[model samples]
Target: QNTTSFGLTPCPKWNPNGTTIAGNSSGLKGNDTSSLDRPIGIFVDVSDNNALYVADHENSRLMKFNRSQHQDQGEAIVPSGIISAESVFLDREKSIYVAGGGKVMKVIVSGVGETILDGETEGEIGFHELSMTLYGIVVDSNDSLYISDGSYHRVVKWEKNSTNGTLIAGVTGEYGDDSTHLDFPHGIYVDFDYDALYVADINNNRIQRFHPIGNLTGETVAGGNGHGNGLGQF
Candidate 1:
């Protein structure tokens, strides 16, 4: 699910009225296991019959929806321990990773969750700290994790089995619309082939592409013309 192949041309038209495969069609919200509350992040497991995993934010849990069975109600896989789970990611090993409560946690299906990166813990890098206001989580092919720290206004890279994270994009604790900065970054994606990272600069209303190898500054690939209803706006 983490890997993506785009086949559409630029400015491709999409269906405005999309069908709802899971959750209430009427936009109803509930805390019940059958329903979801403030689901923030979703990952589709293509290998697992296209099963969808959602980070139920307000519910503080992870929900799994099986598309093969046409199930409307999602099963609570990780029921608790992740307060305000903002994002979820699944590695090739089938281990689930969650970002919430100022930490990144790893949980196996039907098992307890373990904190892999805690904000309170001192990072191995100099003066770098993981913030509680984490939004998106994605793992690269090398098993390293990339997370968007909303409060810190930057994206961090945590190597496998590493306690500290390296600042891959944006300045630490700084927010801006400049190429060298980011404002409340949300979702993140890694293009392994290009060796680049794409970040959803939420407040900046743009998508940025950053090369993690040697360059920290980002190039605006789309939507930097301010927020509006225009076709080029975001």
Candidate 2:
């Protein structure tokens, strides 16, 4: 669902033990259409009857699990050509965005896939020139894409039908724990109402918030102290 609210709503206290709504309860991995192998990214399409879309990474495809039906098996939606699918996002129009294999693809529910951004290919207008190892992807209300380029250690914003992407956070090819730097950024989320971008800075073990309006340097929102099992640690 599209939201215009800023900041996160505190989740109500619930049971610590959670139920497995999809996939095998034993955590077994499989390559079949009914099972998932190294599924990395997931998006719940609340608008579409709460259908859960998964980036079936190792299987190189996308899977859709219907919540209403409470099915254990997921239907393979985009059945092929999404090698090492790392992340998946669904826009307001129900268009699917997939990130994998140094490329980002746009796919419809009917299974038509189009490569919109190819990091391996060069010299194409509106295509990124850098070799991107994409991890996370989120599309804004305007259909602009915010992607975490793991190889580049940065986050970039690709305007809808634009020439190239603009750097949103971190420096290209640089990694650091400083405010202006990031290391192997993974998941990314855009708050439309806040006009901010949240990044899971993987290597740095922190979460960063970047405001595209004026500030290029980001602020640490969580887990910047150090890696540990204790509180306030990553």
Candidate 3:
């Protein structure tokens, strides 16, 4: 079920109709020299959408691949900064932000090295009591970050250059179907135009929206009936 394809308009020799050029029905690791295991996160380069970055989770590395070429697998970049990255977001400045291990880091691609959240010693507060698992991250127009704290069942927001984060939605230690609660929340998005935040309330099988200014509580926008592979159900 995992394969790589190309555009039909290109009309390459190997695949005239643009079918899968890599991976196979056998489900085997396509390449011996370079392969992926538990590829968890993918992000298209901000400068070029054709270039991709994959968080090779199990392999403990990040990869870069150019879609137009036949590079069976990606080239590993920033091999040591992350232990297990759950999400990646590229800002307008082309800096990469990674979320994992209850810490969000900034990795500058231009050899500036990695910078983690500053603690009190650096003259700012930090995440002393962060959730066990972190997933999904999005940076808003103002360079603020919103992260989905999976283990704690809540969404947290960290402002630009701020050491600590504020709970934007859901109550910590509480998980339920109620408007103010979240269960296994993942993949958060911020609509700057509306000043609203949307969360994929995974375990609750619904999507919820919270307004930062007026309402910190989330209201279900989709799914609530139950967990099922039916219409309107996540």
Query: Compared with the true structure, what per-residue lDDT tens digits does model 2 show for residues 176-210?
Result: 99999999998987877777889999888889998
Distance from true position, residue 220, model 3, in Å? 1.7
Give the residue spans of candidate 1 off by over 4 A: 9-11, 109-112, 121-128, 212-214
Preferred candidate (TM-score higher): 2 or 3:
2
Query: Tens digit of lDDT per residue, candidate 1, span 37-68?
Result: 78888989998999999988888888889999
Q: Give the alpha carbon lDDT tens digit for every residue of 18-124 in model 3.
A: 54322232445433325666566677763575577766655655667776676666665656445566677777776777766666667786835464653213322
Q: What ordering of candidates by TM-score runs from best to worst? A: 1, 2, 3
TM-score of 1: 0.90
Pairs that clash in candidate 3: none
Q: What lDDT would each prediction earn against the true structure?
A: 0.82, 0.79, 0.68
What lDDT score goes with residue 20 in model 3? 33
How many pairs collide in each candidate, listed in order?
Answer: 1, 0, 0
Highest TM-score model number:
1
* TM-scores of all predicted structures: 0.90, 0.89, 0.78
